[model samples]
Target: MGYVLGLGGPYHHDAAACLVGDGRVLAFAEEERFSRIKHHRDSRSAAQSAAWCLRQSGIGWADIDDVAVAWNPYWPNYCDRIGDAELIAELLGPDARAAGAPRRLTVIGHHLAHAASAFYPAGVTEAAVLVVDGSGDGVSTSIHHGSPVGLRTVRELPYTQSLGWMYQNATTHVGLGDWTNAGKLMGLAAYGQPRIELPFLHLTDDGYHLDLTRYGLPPFLGADATSRYTDFSYYRDLKLAYAKAFTDAGVPAQPPGGHHPDRMAVDLATSVQAALQQAMLALATNALTLTGTATLCVAGGVALNCTSNGILARTPAIADLFVQPAASDAGCALGAALECARRRGDFTVPGPRQAHTLLGPEYSHAAIETALAAAGARYSTPDDIAAAAAHRIAAGQVVGWFQGRAEAGPRALGARSILADPRSTTLRDHVNRDVKRREMWRPLAPSMLDLTSWTTTPHGPAEAMIVAHHATDTAHEQIPGVVHVDGTLRPQRVDPQIQPTYARLLREIQAETGHAVVLNTSFNGPGEPIVATPADALASGARLGLDALAIGDYLVDLTASNTTR
Candidate 1:
């Protein structure tokens, strides 16, 4: 029942840490925020984030009762547990260990942590849980039934049949960066037709079949085979294979940095996307039948696919769905802590539902002012910061809105976002080109006060912007800037109670622009993590030439010095 620290990685991407006390998540953060790296792929860097969590929670190292690692060194095969213990000891530091800290240390399977993450935070009495991701502990996908008793495994698929690797390979084949660039692939899929047939994926009554050999890719896990993620030769083989496949298909591969992608790339993206949705639907159907539950909760990296989540939500098979906001490997840290607490009889049935992800660091007014002064920026304390920022957006200005704690996941909610008027298509293009410096085809998302007016169907809980919905005609006419070319949007519906200030801003925008939607993106430029501190916010705002920055209760204006708008 005491404080338990959960460490996610020293071996995986998106390293993170979480602290739990009295069966509740006290603090959770990804190492990327502190390291300033996109995914913080180096798991050793997670120590800094873990230290920050303890500091943020005002809990000393001596106060921590247990430490839980999200990786199992003795799963299916044995790894060097002694090396891992040494790493953990180093992470804890000699000074802390000398103070009688960390009474117990526990390690759990990776997919089990993923399941705990999705099932516990979902706050459902009983549901079917699905964990789908790249290879984790030799398993890529699993199905479980969650009840008051806990989660029970139903089925598991080996890493060799991974859907995640299939998508990642296809992403690279189409000339999108790599596995990290799957989101770009998903976005590009909207611009093409699904005419290309991928024979590697076959949907069945149970789960689906994925054959990597069809694409000239080798098995992800085997006695002698190594992970393709770290194998450069695998990529070389992939290039040659894709070259042959493209030549046989009579299409050319798209190169990076272009206004328009090649026809073949888009078609491939579309086909893969279609196949992924179908396969996910089939798998969900099987989970529902196996667990005999009407509600479903999903986690792991693949759960971040908002397009597939939208399709699942739209289908009649899934009555209710809960997709973890921080579904990536980073979220496994939180799940580990929760699982540890539950096993120790600290957490009760139907644990607290994570209504929001504003779990990272928060700055005070004095800190914001100090940072603002250090930046030598022109600023003022507005009577109504939301009203001021909304008026600026109404004047067609892109503004940085930094409020409360930073978000825990990749998507930027109201906490740390760049807000703009969503009425003009020109504004969207301008933000993409000048501010974001990303592909023109990649669409911006929206945070709305009333989501029902924008989307055509009920798209489950979108408080996290992790699910996409077909846009209604009203949305296209009113907020084209946030709408994609395919008439779909990944929208975040603001909850007044949880985000009162942001909801107030949306209301102000409604008064001025006659719509409750505003274009909301992460408060950082290209190749940077979201701003974690006021200094980060000010520096990014200045570098990106933002019109205004609403940090805490102060409004910093930069219109006099910048004329880009």
Candidate 2:
């Protein structure tokens, strides 16, 4: 079995790395979690992430058989300059280059890698694959039929026609960074109903197309680059167009002290989200029509929309659905490695590996103690960490729960998460405003311990918190904090065997509160990547307004009003 290292995100958000050996993922992690810079863009974007993967996997650079990066310098689809090659070349180590031996440094197509990321590990032999993002080698979306043998592209939509850009525009208007705020808009959209549309966004028979004249930006994807740092601006004039439209519509900018998108902002967010959903559905239906595949696999940045994913999951056209947990650009590295492996044309298909996303570094009990000691934190090593955490949440105290290996994807899952009482809807406001420092319109998610008793129609393995589901009245009454304004929820429901710590905590909380749910979110402050280390968790707890922290065996009281007991 040959070992291949996969790297991604030199260009955009969620810079990440993965080690795939024999077509199975050994280790993976995002650079942002390690660097503490959200969506970090740097020459060493994949270097730290790659080193972490090697450390966790107990392997060295000498053992690597190949390196696959998900950027093709010369894809005919996009007219951008061929700098992706230079970027990859700059990241290679000198020792590797000094060797006279031949090495594989393969450049894989952007969208093909996106397709492979979903197809190879999906545990399915055949499926209709869709890749949608802000831009992929110059295109916004691609549809393909994926099988064990290979993937064949059926249709393509250029970057000018981008649902992703539209989402980013709305997200930026609400103060979330353009590249990193689509989720905020998706969360906000639930609070509103679309009563209008702007001329900038439109859906056609082919797909969604953004009219530059209406968007008020140049037609090119990154045309905002000016004379100095060459850093591209995200929809500068396009944002002005939104601001003008909102002003004309009588929608005021969000007031001081973070709050929900004022009434009219919510309306526009709703419109953008609805339009994107409709356009995506149209494309997915066409994918089904073209490929005649019962299963659909979604990849790329836009696929992270759990609301659209929920709607797609319930579609009558597709019988099965799978959203690559690391559906963003980060997973493209994994996809690139998988595609490179298949290009060798010599390996047999392996068992399903799609659902295993806990590929990052895990901390031992000793390490957590070290971090506590370093911070001069006062704490007690509880025999039952999960119970202690459950008790705190049950008592209406928000608990920062950090355990085991960090999840490779965006969702926190149970490993590195913030836990709270789901019974109180008002807690959503507390966490949203004080902890996350985001608008209250964003709903918290329920991480259910047991799925059997829950009142939800989970369309897929929601353990990774990807698909949105309509909540039953039982969910609404018992765990209102998790239920969104639209009576829907995107839950992280895990198997007891898979996450015993979280499951035990839920059971303990259930014993206390009579419900098997907790309001769970990524263990980080707003605009930050999920916490990666014990120190990261410790520092963020006090700043993010958490009451306490359950780090491994230690229970740290983080109520700053009191001592750090």
Candidate 3:
């Protein structure tokens, strides 16, 4: 067995790991899931995920043949945090590395890894690749072409002009913090019009260029600043960076809560989203022009821009599009592993395609029972767990649904999710205010038994929540709780073949309410990472304002006063 362990993060956020053997991924996990920290910003967190991956493979570090790191310190420039042989040694510990003598070590370019994660797992023969994020390996965006034969670069852009950072600064200006709240900004964009423009940004032959002076920033970051990261924590007038970019465009700045009718925050979000989508569209089109590939794959933080992804999927230049579900930095490890496997001639042409992303850990019924028993809560061994969960949702009672394996990405695709009735318009606010205690503007996502059942899109049978979809009028009426203000929704298409449990639950809901949709959010409340273990699930279900938790064959009703009903 050619055991290849791929690692990401520990240097920054979204740390993750994937272990590959015999040309297939054995396991993959993100640090934040185990650590219970949202985007756990440490290498140790990712190292923990690596250890978990190794354990799932039933092997130790000493048995591994190679270590493939997702970041290269030498690309465009050098940084001390980049993971190399010594860094890997440090992570695995001296003892483990010592036993795995002369273990092959490999470095993958950040964007290349992103491309690999998208193209390889997607099972695409040849596709134009687009990788975008907040600066990795000194580049914010790169274009490539991927085939089972190999992956080839078309062009790479410098980090000086980053769409991701502009979006981040915009996020901060609107009261949401950067990195984590960027998606909130995406949701906010739907409420207003795009009445502004950035004067310093324009498309170039390669990609786009920006002048920081437009936002009162220098042409470049500080000399000591690493090209891969430009001071997100302590920048002077950080919000003003993107705020002025809009205020200078003759639009007013938004109020604190971003709610007022004539306010500019929503408009700024709208314009930022528009500019980003247009730029990404250009990049994807150009990738096709340069590579002459009809199929396309996108990854990286910007690839997480679901609106842009939806637009890109509809572009005539692209015959097929596949965006990795974990398009963010957490997916880089999977890409690195795929890249190493290619080098070893194990990732053959037309490589293995992912049937699903249930790559994280799963808990047994014994563990679930133990957790519920320890919590001193009311629970039951329901003969029909799915039917009971469906009844709760249909009765307008919120539920914490924990079943099978935990999902890998930020989405709660059935497995570790809070389920609610999607037919009520007030449900969104209830979940936001009473349950999640999050910003009121935050919208809820949904899982449909079939994409065609609700959404009207030419694009997919997608299981990952990486792309966006527009709702049909029928959907608007039936699933009002899940639809956003702009009539668009981020939906996960639960496959019956791979996700039988989740699909059956949806069917049960349909049997009760005539609608096969449920508002699905992560199992945890605001500011908490998605719950991983049954103990975590039990703890979150008790305090998250959920009425019941449907885990394994057991149904735990928190609202009831009894121990087992």
Model 3 / residue 420 / CA error / Å: 1.1
Residue lDDT tens for model 2, 519-558: 9998988668888889998899988878999988789988
lDDT of 1 by residue, 99-149 (tens): 655644677678888888899998889999998987677678999999988
TM-score of each: 0.94, 0.90, 0.92
Q: Single out the weakest 10-residue window by summed lDDT for candidate 2.
A: 223-232
lDDT of 3 at 229: 49
Off by over 4 Å in 1: 78-84, 89-104, 214-222, 225-251, 562-565
Relative to the true structure, candidate 2 reaches a TM of 0.90
Residue ranges of candidate 2 with Cα displaced over 4 Å = 42-44, 74-86, 92-104, 174-176, 213-260, 345-350, 452-456, 560-565
lDDT of 3 by residue, 1-565 (tens): 8888777654567888888897798898998988778888644446678778877878877777777777775554553234356755655545555655335557787878888898888787888888988877777889888876789987887676778888887776766665777888888888788877667678765557777675776555555345324444324443456677666776665454544424566777888888888788888878888888898888888888778888886677788888898888888889988888888887776775676778899888788778877888788777889998999899989999888877888888888899899999787788888888877777888888776767778246357777778888888888888888887788887778888888989999999999788898878877789999988988888887688899888888888766553
Name the best candidate (by lDDT): 1
Q: lDDT scores for all predictions? A: 0.82, 0.77, 0.78
Using lDDT as the measure, what is the rank order of every candidate, best first? 1, 3, 2
Choose the strongest candidate by TM-score.
Answer: 1
